[model samples]
Target: MNISEQQIWDLTNQAIDKLGANASPDMIRDYVEKEIANRHGGSLPTEKFEGRVIITAFGINKPGIVAKITGSLAEMEIDLQDISQKIMQNFFTLIMIVDITSSPRNLKEVQEELARVGKELTIKIYAQHEDIFQYMFRI
Candidate 1:
């Protein structure tokens, strides 16, 4: 049975509502899987789901920061799933969710590249697999 994107979204929304602010990534994932199994009378679909990475950077505000970072990701064929950034005065913080399944480089390579870029720009950047990130930051 094929599940539409809308179905996934609805399931995700329901999970969020049920779990509220205490929900971790693993919790949501498990909730969705259980819901799908209950509704479809089987396990999740056979489609492969690639792991994602979380990228975070922060430093004094400067021009071309986003451009440079995104450009490097593009060069490595990384797909940006979502991004949020905020700048206050001279400081800025950026967070991004990226899919590196298409990239020729692995997570460590990506982190090294981003670290180099951050050093060049005098900022701080960190990358972690979503699972590790979620585990480390669980509420």
Candidate 2:
């Protein structure tokens, strides 16, 4: 099928309606969620539970970038386990590691939130570790 944006969206809406009519609200929600997740390629990546999210903030650095970054995590109740930073070339590279809650059963939400903030500033998150180099390039 020649699936266009409009077609995909229409199908999703129809699915939502069918589920709503046949099942409870929770069931519809689950159906819509499953449909959405399937669109992202079956299943999401397995996030590293314990790793650092290194963000480099720049571009006038804005005003509330720092607070927004920390605040979002705070609202999610994700614990800021550790942080490191340095200012160079008028930029702040904040490498933070957060202890995400197990109840959520996923780190994608936290990653998505970080990605949204990155669009506003020069931000990046890398899994920093001594063995990363040895495992990757083996150079």
Candidate 3:
């Protein structure tokens, strides 16, 4: 079965509630895995989960920044769902909603690739799965 982002979020919340505040990362992971397995008749899904990711980048404004970033994303076959950007004086901030379901690279690999691009361009780039982004930024 292909898991949706909402399902992952719900599972995470359930794990937190059941495990409490003191749960280690491993414990939470194991709990979620077991829950998924139990729900799926003792086997985990083999397909990759389809989800969107929020990509944020910020640094001094310069030429070709968007091109460079989008170029890398294109190479990975990640679709850019939407983008918003602002330039204030010499600083620039960009936010993109990307669909990674078709991408060959996973979230971590995409992050690493973006990190390398950021380092080369002297900027900061971050990629977070939509569920994590919502949880972190929720009011």
Candidate 2 or 1, higher lDDT: 1
lDDT of 2 by residue, 1-139 (tens): 2358986788678776776557777776677667656776785435545443333344443466668788877876766777766677766566676566432434666667677767655565433332454578786
Q: On a 0 to 100 scale, what is the lDDT of residue 58 in model 3?
A: 100
lDDT over C-alpha atoms for residue 97 of model 3: 98
Candidate 1 deviant stretches above 4 angstroms: 1-50, 136-139
Please name the candidate that would achieve the greatest TM-score relative to the true structure: 3
Best by lDDT: 3
Which regions of candidate 3 are displaced past 4 Å?
1-49, 136-139
Clashing pairs in 1: none
Task: Candidate 1: give its CA RMSD in angstroms.
Answer: 15.3
Better of 1 and 3 by TM-score: 3
lDDT of 3 at 92: 94
TM-score order, best first, reads 3, 1, 2
TM-score to true structure, per model: 0.61, 0.47, 0.63
TM-score of 1: 0.61
How far off is residue 19 in model 3, in Å? 41
RMSD of each: 15.3, 10.9, 10.5
Tens digits of lDDT, candidate 3, 1-139: 6789999999988987899989998998899889999888897755564799999999999999999999999999999999999999999999999999998777878999999999999999999889986887896
